[model samples]
Target: MGEALRTIAFKVKTASCGGTQCVNSFGDEQLAVDMLANNLLFEALKHSHFCKYACSEEIPELQDMGGP
Candidate 1:
């Protein structure tokens, strides 16, 4: 997706076996990029697509749940 939210910049990134999203807070991009170390990946996970699997910044531990 092309940046639509007035607060955050969303980039759709796909994987070989799943999908993921990279969200950067807009209007306050710099700070948001830095706050990632403190925010929970799952919390940012809402309202987005319910992909077959979700991964944090770099595809941490994940289990396949088949397909939905």
Candidate 2:
């Protein structure tokens, strides 16, 4: 998670935060950075092998990650 966040922080510092936009699950305007951060964290947790479920502001529903 730390690594993912760090990567996202670096991206935010080096790139434009408004590169893209879309509507999230909650119908809120989502930016590219927002999606990137969410995907980063989700991948981090999924690969960590301990996260069975996750939820975020961008996706306000619990997601199953095939954990046992």
Overall lDDT per candidate, in order of appearance: 0.35, 0.86
List, residue by residue over 1-68, the lDDT tens digit for candidate 1: 12233223332122132322444433322333333332334333432445355544333455343335
Clashes of 2: 0
Instruction: For candidate 2, write residues 1-68 as lDDT tens digits.
Output: 78998999998888786555888777888888888888999999998888899999888899986577
Q: What shift in Å separates residue 18 of candidate 2 from its native position after superposition?
A: 3.3
Residue pairs with colliding backbones in model 2 are: none
Among all windows of ten consecutive residues in candidate 1, which has the lowest summed lDDT?
Answer: 11-20
Scored by TM-score, the top model is 2
lDDT of 1 at 3: 23
The per-residue C-alpha lDDT of model 1 at residue 61 equals 51
For candidate 1, the per-residue lDDT at 21 reads 40
